[model samples]
Target: MKAVLIEADTISSAWSQLIYEIYKNGEEHKPDYSMSTRRLHATVAINDVDNNQINSFVPFGENLIKKYKEELTEEYAEWYISLPDDDKRKFDYCYAKQLFRYGETAYNTLSENLKNLRVGSRRHVGVLWENEVHIPKFEDQPCWIAYKLELLNETDVLLYILYRSWDAYGGFPANLPAIVEGFKKVFREKKLPYRIESLIATGWDTHIYESDLQAVEKIFKIAQLCPKCGNLTPKHALISTTKGKVCTQCKCRM
Candidate 1:
């Protein structure tokens, strides 16, 4: 069967209820559930995100965590550290997939020379970090990695990218402009000619958040809906969009 979309009309309605159960009920006072690690457990039904399925279970998982250790790679066992109570549920699913192929095929592609890289025999790991975004444009339901990296100079850099799945139902808008710029800077500073060779867009849930469903539709109205047909137009697909348009698909001048 072909992929279908999740129909989330009133998506944000559950947020308030979710917060109440975790805070007011003192879930910490309750006994443990099976293999469950989150401080809060509330099952939510989200319709039409993955497929045209009428209903699907959505769990609440969000947290703020800090990893202070020094290691470019981490064992799965390293998850025992403490995090903000809210983040546990979110991390569990985002991390627990068994069968996975990913956009980060470059996982080990960081030059081996860079690993033990040093300025005059001192060790350095080029790194960066960022969390707790203001305005949080993606509705915050989307999944991705956030982190800070320390340079050879002991200076920390901030990085926020939709690393794993760039095409989830909603993805970050503000994060991209900064990342493209950062991509240019890092390679230039390192004096490397390599470009971001492989940027794989996985899944199709990538979208910016809006307060209500109509606001979400309004974006489609501006981006994809053709004024002539009121139908989602092919001229609006990713490549057709540009700084100034001559549509890539139809070659129609904007």
Candidate 2:
């Protein structure tokens, strides 16, 4: 587990810098920096309450940095991250930064998802998802799913799952939470874990909009980083074009 304590000028700037750092370093290369979550990006983030600024930090699986630390601004408050490799690039970044779980750092959102789902074996399953957040505050919809679990010989743990009923880029926030909460409720009643051995996601494409970039920034600014966990932030400034934002660091699309 690696950790980086990050400070930002307006919190937004800090997070933006952090996200750019991670996007550059992830395993997969996203040519379209603006659209790809795999690439560096920033979102609204929050640091400890003392000072309010966008909070963004990246984590490394291995000891990528040993005794590495620095203050970006002159007051030593905040600025874009900088490493020894270059004068312009910041070194901190990750694709998925696990924030907090049970007072400890989490690995990925999927990790907890697997835990709650309990990896059950099902003969068949169906998943329907609508992932858009309406601007006018429209009526809410729910995704429908069907599941049949074979328990022992005769007993069965049956369930239906939905990641999000609405259509939005940030579906994971609402959908993942719903799934976890549902799992908790079912686990209490059934006693046996609601095992979801298989999942059948509908043919869908999850994407980020240039218009929603600001919303993403605000989210990261408010989003808290889990201690000892990688907090991948998004880019602070992104103008949506058919062409994706290119990483100044890696010379790849962010």
Candidate 3:
């Protein structure tokens, strides 16, 4: 088992560093399911959740942030997860709604407790997994397992998260911000003065799918067309090509 720890001031910075770290050092291991992916474990801590500029890096629609943000709430979770047991079997994928909703939602419990804003109370925790409904064999399950908040002071709230599984490329970016927003909502509803002091996320199995390898390479590639000569060169290099010495900018390349 390999462990990676990343600490950054913003979600974007943390995400960028973690991606590069995994690409450089992650090991390849076959998952239980038939998928082209390997697993790695890492812990990431971000000091600023409000600075979410890294959302731009997500190839998918930015709307996914909103969608994931909703998923962190009890209302959305309850709406999607109210199906009866027999009806739940009809769905192929197990939704997080089941974990966050139908079960005793952590948000509700946390909100109720925060009314008093008691510091150093270990009870400021929320659970997502239910042994009876989830522990039994199922095709898919929620990757996020639980969340806890520690009121370090009257104005600082520290968040801690546990993930049974994590997708570094796609899931990590969205999940972190959304969880922060979700917790912020809890703090706001309680009318308590608070700042997201710090957030720590731990993943038991974090990985990227093999199918996305090429996309990852392109993201970090340094080669780009020389602005002047139109010849490909390392983005930051002065290259001596048949066309002549090409600089990073058009005038030098031309």
- For candidate 1, write residues 1-254 as lDDT tens digits: 11222212222222222222222332222223322111232232222111221111112112111121111122221332223548644343222111011122313222333445333442322211123332354443224343222232332222222243232112222223223334434446567543432221122222222222344344345444223212233344434344533324334534
RMSD of each: 17.1, 20.4, 7.4
Candidate 2 vs candidate 3, lDDT winner: 3
Q: Which regions in candidate 1 have their CA more than 4 angstroms from the true location?
A: 1-143, 146-171, 203-212, 222-254
- Give a tens-digit lDDT track for model 3, residues 1-254: 77999777677666666666667788887877856655668898887779643533455776777887877765665655566767744454333454344364334455555665567876677676667767885556667877777889878888888999888888888888777877787568666688789999999988878887677677669544333433334555756666655654445425
Candidate 1 has its poorest 10 consecutive residues by lDDT at 63-72
| Cα shift from native, residue 14, model 1 (Å) | 28
Ranking by lDDT: 3, 2, 1
Score candidate 2 by lDDT: 0.31
Which sequence of candidate numbers ranks them by TM-score, best first?
Answer: 3, 1, 2
> Which wins on lDDT, candidate 1 or candidate 3?
3
Q: Which ten contiguous residues of candidate 3 have the minimum total lDDT?
A: 224-233
Q: What is the C-alpha lDDT of each candidate?
A: 0.28, 0.31, 0.69
Q: Which stretches of candidate 3 lie over 4 Å from their true place?
A: 53-55, 81-107, 113-117, 223-254
* Local accuracy of candidate 2 as per-residue lDDT tens digits, 1-254: 12233343232233443443432342233333333333222222223212322123322211222112112111111133113436544433211111111112222222233344433454433222213322342433232222223332223233333222222333322332233334334444456544432222220222233454566556566443322222332344333344543223223233
